[model samples]
Target: MNLSLFDQFMSPTMMGIPLILLAMSIPLLLFPTPTNRWLNNRLTTLQTWFLSVFTKQLMLPLNIKGHKWALSLASLMVFLITMNLLGLLPYTFTPTTQLSMNLGLAVPFWLATVLIGLRNQPTAALGHLLPEGTPTLLIPILIIIETISLFIRPLALGVRLTANLTAGHLLIQLISTAVFVLLPLMPVTAIFTAMVLFLLTLLEIAVAMIQAYVFILLLSLYLQENT
Candidate 1:
């Protein structure tokens, strides 16, 4: 039963082709393309407005060098939100639930920020490992600990996203199963469970959006530190 519950996280393949590829591509199509016109449709306008607002907020703390990441970060935010929300639907897979997928997204961006720091300001970057006034004896130990912490950033990013989505999905599934089981035996109890399920669904939706924003936000912070 436990294994079956987790089977949903596995990548689904049909005729030897992974459907996750299709799932990822579908969100791109869902977005409306901008038209070269004075006035655009409401959806496009809303999307543009949201993108502008998000970009502005994200780039606000970043330096000029970090500003270059605005578009990429904005696009990633939209993509992640779409993918997460889509996964909540019936018969859909959430790729972000997979550790490999989340790590794939996290590592490159995190590495880029680290590389930027190393390239542009090596001393400052390396200095993060040690405090301004460290006891001489503790310096090596502090450097080792800080080095480990620095390497763990990407892992934390990936695990945070994967764990939240996985836990939410698992809870939803468990409650939904209970709802069905209790429906005939205890209608009132089932109804209450259904209400809870409805509320949980709403919370999960918020989590879906927030987690994506958080993922991007943390990357931006990392970039800010580097820049």
Candidate 2:
């Protein structure tokens, strides 16, 4: 029996130990640790430069208060980027592709930001429920709508990451299957399709990295509002 295309998305297990945990650990292996020497090797230097640049750009929007989250936010960025890039590799699992795991990552941080806003700035946080100068007739309705939207933020965050990755993976698989089926019977069509598959792979590489960045950037925005 042939396995379903989505079987690839399932968490692979060995003796009941999920490999997702191991997949998550792989990105850290890519980074080179700094040495005491004054001059670092080319790879280390490049890694340092890339991370510093990302941190600088990411932090530029926030005030001094939000800078406190530099470490957490930066670490989240690395974690996400690593997971996404790793998922693109053969026989690798993308943990973020799972809705539960995505929500697990999203809800806590999203709630923390909301709580920070509520605890530190009650009036401002509450004020977000309804804008100033609203007509008396619409006040209750507006508040209800805003409240629903507020609670949906975490759900949106989780679903967005999962859906994008899942769709990209599915499309890649469908095209690949077609390429194999058509190779002998329709050589010209298969060749054209193969080109498209190659281009899509490149695009998927970009999507993986970008979806990771988008996730962290949105979280930073939420934190910025709270701080």
Runs off by more than 4 Å, candidate 2:
1-3
- In candidate 2, what are the lDDT values of residues 1-227, reduced to their tens digit? 13699898899899998887787788888888889999999999887787889889988999887788888878888888788888888878889899999999999999999999999888999999999999999999999999999899999989999999999999899999999999999999999999999999999889888888898899899888887
Instruction: Estimate the TM-score of every prediction.
Output: 0.98, 0.95
Write the residue-wise lDDT of candidate 1 on 153-227 in tens digits: 999999999999999999999999999999999999999999999999999999999999999999999998889
Error in Å for residue 58 of model 2: 1.7
- Flag clash pairs in model 1: none
Error of model 1, residue 12, in angstroms: 0.9
lDDT of 1: 0.95
Candidate 2 achieves a global lDDT of: 0.89
Relative to the true structure, how large is the alpha-carbon lDDT of every model? 0.95, 0.89
